[model samples]
Target: MSSSPEKFSKNAVIVNELGLHARSAAKIAEIARTAKSKIWVIRDGEKADAASIIDMLALACSKGTRVTISADYSEDIEILNRIKALIQNGFGE
Candidate 1:
């Protein structure tokens, strides 16, 4: 499906001690790939494609960083929630 400007977002903090590192970014990207709608992680007014490891890493999100996880469509809200849960869980680190 095409991405829309409209989206649902939830704020979350990076709980992993090591932060959003390569391994954790990979997990987030993997989840993003499964979503039918576009997904993104926004931090400090910067947004990154959730499916791109490089983009996620670019956020420079360290532990305790606050970010907003959003999906382009309401139907994809669950996807964002999953992402939030992953971040809250420290990407299972």
Candidate 2:
């Protein structure tokens, strides 16, 4: 893989009232695991593996929580976008 910074990062807020609990975290983790890239989520400057549902849920992302996502590799863009959309759309209820 080209280590030429072929990555994209974004800071976003969690808008879901229920926060990133098990089901929501599962959804995100499932998608992240299928991606051909390394994904991470940062909260309060602490980062965790995005592909791990347990790790994500441990973050306890409540409503209005800010998170920084960083993905290393080209295919990460679409995945990141979907993640952002999920957060924005309230995890589709």
Candidate 3:
């Protein structure tokens, strides 16, 4: 029997003055695209594919919005951390 990979998640608040806009979403999608498993950005219980800029933008997360960065597989923990750091750092705005 195969065991399911462990999920990794981290919470971060949008600190950028512009919030999670197109540029920031694109940055996240860039990193997420390299994940070994799925990466998700969740806000107010809604989940968006981190690899999809449109999906992330649809969340409409403004500054100060709290979100969770999640990875489906443990192998993606680095990806999860990178996203969390990016959000926490306000996308380097």
Query: Per-residue CA lDDT of candidate 3, range 1-93, in tens?
Result: 123323478889999999899999999999999998888899988989999999999999999899988887788899988988888888888
Per-candidate TM equals 0.90, 0.87, 0.92
Error (Å) of candidate 3 at residue 47 is 0.5
For residues 1-93, what per-residue lDDT tens digits would candidate 2 score against the true structure?
A: 446432487778888889988888888888788789888888997777889988888788999999887788867888888887887788988
Q: How well is each residue in 1-93 modelled by candidate 1, as lDDT tens digits? A: 455444488899999999988999899899999998778899988999999999989999999999988887888788888889999988887
Listed per model in order, the count of residue pairs whose N, CA or C atoms clash below 3 Å is 0, 0, 0
The stretch of ten residues in a row with the least summed lDDT in candidate 1 is 1-10
Ranking by lDDT: 3, 1, 2
What order do candidates take by TM-score, descending? 3, 1, 2
lDDT on C-alpha atoms for all candidate structures: 0.88, 0.82, 0.89
1 or 3, which is superior by TM-score? 3
Candidate 2 differs from the real structure by a C-alpha RMSD in angstroms, to one decimal, of 2.4
Which wins on lDDT, candidate 2 or candidate 3? Answer: 3
1 or 2, greater by TM-score: 1
Candidate 3 ranges with C-alpha deviation above 4 Å: 1-6
